[model samples]
Target: MKRLAPHSPATLACTMLLALASQTTPAAARDADKPRPVVDFTSCAKPAWPKADLAARHSGTVTLSFNIDSQGKADAGTVVKSSGHAGLDEAARSGIAKCRFKNGPGAVQMQYVWVTE
Candidate 1:
């Protein structure tokens, strides 16, 4: 049996970005029992892996928290969870900021995983 190094390329696994269950603020007149709408990222471009991070083989998942404006634009994206790497975290934050959701005026949180090829 052979062992692979932790930082080795063979040990790296890329995970697709996943949008977890969302939470929304209820409108003043809206019912509390109604389900919140899902965020639609139809116009979002995928985040690019930071060149330096990739060179150093940094990998982790970044969780971003943000609010979507009425125009469907994500505003004030903050890193609720760090990926243990600044580059990866910033990449996720900037990428998500450009996203436009179909249903907006609410809060959203999503995760982006970074792995070396």
Candidate 2:
């Protein structure tokens, strides 16, 4: 009777490769939570500057924290920080709501900056 060699070089290599492929590395998992529908601020049309604030040369940053659901849509979160201008704050929220993410079920925060030159 012939016994199977479980430790054969070829067999061992195949097993190791399989194990590695099936296991998710920490780095991979960490990077897995990526935004979908890709947030391209460069392409995002700039929101209109509030007339009153614009005239005064107001500039500020709004930080928003939100959840990305399974469908990759922003689940309507809140502004973690305000930009001191209602218009800027609302604009930041509006743009965020339009975003979609992938590998989510987690929190996402973004900052929107407004400046008048």
The best candidate by TM-score is: 1
- Every model: Cα RMSD to truth: 4.0, 23.6
Looking at model 2, which ten-residue stretch has the lowest summed lDDT?
14-23
lDDT of 1 by residue, 1-117 (tens): 687775576866555576754654456236355434355557777787777887678888888888777788888689988999999999889987887776556677888888665
Question: 50-111, model 2: which lDDT tens digit per residue?
Answer: 66665555678877776666766667668778988887688667766776555555566667
| Candidate 2, RMSD to the unseen true structure | 23.6
Candidate 2 displacement at residue 98 in angstroms: 0.9
Residue 80, candidate 2: how far off, in angstroms? 1.0
The collision pairs in model 1 are none
Per-candidate clashes come to: 0, 0
